[model samples]
Target chain A: MTVKLYDLAHSRAGDKGNTLTLSLIPYNADDYELLRVRVTAEAVRHHLRDIVAGEVTRYELPNLPALQFVCQQALTGGVTTSLTMDTHGKSLSYALLEMKIER
Target chain B: MNERIRIGCGAGFSGDRLEPALVLLQQANLDYLVLECLAERTIALAQKRKRQNPPLGYDPLLERRIELLLPDLIARNVRLITNMGAANPLAAAEKICGIARRLNLSITVAAITGDDVFHLLSGDEKALETGQPLTASGPLVSANAYLGADAILPALATKANIIITGRVADPSLFLTPLMHEFGWLPDNADQMGQGTVIGHLLECAGQLTGGYFADPGMDVPGRKNVPDLAHLGHPFADILPDGTATFGKVAGTGGLLTLATAKEQLLYEVMDPSRYLTPDVVADFTQVRLEEVGPNQVRVSGGRGQAAPGTLKVSVGYDAGFVGEGEISYAGSKAVGRAQLAGAIIQERLRDRFPDLRVDYIGSTSVHRTSFGEYPDPYEIRLRVAGKASTASMAALVGEEVEALYTNGPAGGGGARKYVHELVGIVSTLMDRRTITPQLTLFQS
Candidate 1:
């Protein structure tokens, strides 16, 4: 089932050639370890490359535990998969909201 | 002689529909009927009415309603205290008195006014956001802060059966007559608490009873196939002289009153529960309890007391921003996805051209779609954009883009329309004294 995408991370340094530059936001140690065990770096890079059209840089699981993402600007072309809109008409920093499993 | 003085709090402003809210008072059935309708925005409307007409310049609907129901009310001998005097309450009262005289009924109508403080403010610019001299924000649309009910005492003392005012707080409307009848001092903490709780219970008419309750199963009076909802609409309170109080919406309304609905409204817009501040008193909402008194009414009691801080919350709404609405449809094979692409294109276009347009997307759907988890997929999307200034221009720009959607390419040929933008103000004012005796005038027909 489609779920709310939480633990969002935004692009840190603008990477032009890299198809998937990593964006990392501080995360909990437990959650970081959990995602690492479930989701792999290659799977994320491939999924991101289809939308980002950039090379996937190496994944960095920070010691501080953070929301790690293979990043790109929000896609504008082709078919749309899922859309999340804010009521206040402004882009929010991914770091501001916490992601949780919908009960 | 109905020794039991029942006070009903009337919400909203409808000069035309005013009688239904106050009809019970016609027979000395109740001692007081309080009509409340003066939000920061409504005050602005009142000012606009004054500019358009010399006096009694409101919607005129309430006045018309009063004219129709005056005979019955007079025969009933019920007293009324209302804030129906928007821009010119005195003018409104004059009109009511005229109506009374034409019917050969000698009724006393009194008006309480002059709380409009927009002109009295001097020095310090009203800062838009704590800037410059404290007063230099911009031209004030409406500057009437929620004043204490003490101002109405002067008018109530006139022994005029009816009292009218301009922009009184909702709770203060019900509490004013109580204060006058009970001779409760402004500083009387216990009485103040009692009155405050009483005001909350009656403020929403049937709302306290079962109007907005949570249980769908509970058989609410009016909703339960009952008739003459009016006769059943009686909200009562068991208030003590010490300020301890419990109350519920009487009966005769079609709604439910459960712990959920009671708690929801109880927490509605309250900043500090321990000190639920109002113009009348600093009340405590934290310890209040809600119990089902009957099928319809819910008793609210046990509110603690708190010392009020000096600052008064003045709702001041200024031009926050402007919003624009437009629509687009998808008919192609990948209709939904194509519509999404259109939204993206519009956003891209706005960013490229204005670089400042704040746009948001809202999708509307008739059928539920499982693609987005539990929520259904929206067939049509409503796109909105708002900005700090030049909202009209932004709205126009969006309108232009929407019209071009048909000619530029695909994405359905849905039309675009512009909506109006209006904002008011509510600011907090600090006052050293607790009470003020306002000027009262009686107009007799």
Candidate 2:
């Protein structure tokens, strides 16, 4: 069955300079391998093309069963200089959650 | 039973609530309390103030925080480690000593300085952004290096009841107490890694407790949500000599401590899970494990590391000129069309002068530009217009233009507001650790 990523996983967003990093974790740790294959860096780059201006790189944490995504040029010009209302891109994680993947 | 050091974090940032910290200090039976009050741009902004008016660059909230916590710290004999010093550690330390005297208490305070390297910059150093010279950012306001736990070692050795610092890494404040209490050598990679992991966990204080966790009650099935955040208490750790620790908060407090929260926090603001670099050590969080031993109790283990990095990261703040903004509220029928028309007018009016002007629809597309699912039009919409310019007067035009919308006939635009303020730009660079020296100045009441 197919379900929204938000139903299968939860995420958090963080920033350093113009780079925005988001952590994606499955609600069930046992769903790690299944979600890992479905949520690819290429898929996220395509998913967030409207917001992300640069490349997206994914790193895996097997122990925590979480995925960390490093998105480039995401904040426009960092916090103090960004023109966006969401300066830190805090809600970008929710945007990622909108993706639909295999359950 | 293994000897354990009890540590708690009071303030995660400069303007955090005093109540949660008070709760931790009074009830947690903590041996040490850390208040991480410095952000990336805080010290840079503070340094700018110090240059304009000497000795006035410390944290504005430092006095109130110290005034409230000093007695408890002295009475409970709980040592304080904080980076509230901002740009001037010595001045901050002196101010704390003054407060202690007025409170009729005898306490030793020390300040860790030398994070400011603005005067030492050659101007030819490359900025981390575009490989351009650091001076390209214009007359820089401040440049302070992110100091490691080693920089704080001398202050801890002074046996001071309170240690104030400027521009130290957030995790270093929590890591120093562990280093001192356990006699963990600076070069002990494994031990330093473990301490750093715990430090990272507890550094944000309330974040570990559900301050930033996702909300509950979504239509999506099966999300175990965070509860009792209204009176949420900060997190504290019971650390063993071998770098093992059990993290928990005060009993009868609001908040949940579970494997889910820990997993989310484990990668919060983290770019790489394995190579988590800090000034203290090259912490590796990949092998780390978390287990909920009991209700509101989680045991965190398996944090490893390598040698510390050779260079220290520096936050350089520069004057980014001024930003002028204006907001107008539109309610009732046809609010959406009116707000969009107002935004278009403002954008058109300033198109020649401020090409980078921005307009946002507050009630609708302000936060997320694209909606995930289906959504209906709202009854109310607030239109916001903002633009940046080199001069304050130039920036103010953005607000004036927006305010003119009322008379200019956007039709029923109410509650108009206008404002203009200066802005700061931040960039980072790296300097050899050997070049920067940390010095501790002592004070007594």
Report the TM-score of chain B alone for all candidates. 0.78, 0.97
Q: Across residues B247-334, which tens digit of lDDT does each residue of candidate 1 receive?
A: 5443433344544344434543333445667767788654566665665445556655555446444433233334444555554355
Error of 2 at A40 (Å): 0.8
Clashes of each: 40, 0
> Per-residue alpha-carbon lDDT of model 1 for A1-103, expressed as tens digits?
3222243221122111111233333223355554554345464544433234433333433332333343333222111111223221112222112222322
Return the lDDT, model 1, position B98: 80
The regions of model 1 sitting more than 4 angstroms off are A1-103, B1-3, B12-28, B56-61, B102-104, B123-136, B211-252, B307-324, B328-336, B348-356, B364-376, B385-395, B413-415, B431-437
- lDDT per residue as tens, model 2, B1-445: 3389999998998889888888899999999999988888777778888989997899989999999999999999999999999999999999999999999999999999989998878778899986898879776888999999999988888879999999998888988988888889989998888898999999888888877884676775436566678898899999999889999999988887788878877788888777888998899999998999998899999999999999999888888889999999999998999999999888878899998888989988777666644567789999988889999999999889888998994899999999998888888899999999988889998
lDDT of 1 at B205: 57
Weakest 10 consecutive residues of candidate 1 chain B by summed lDDT: B365-374
Instruction: State the lDDT at B94 in candidate 1.
Output: 85
Q: Score the docking of each candidate (DockQ).
A: 0.02, 0.75
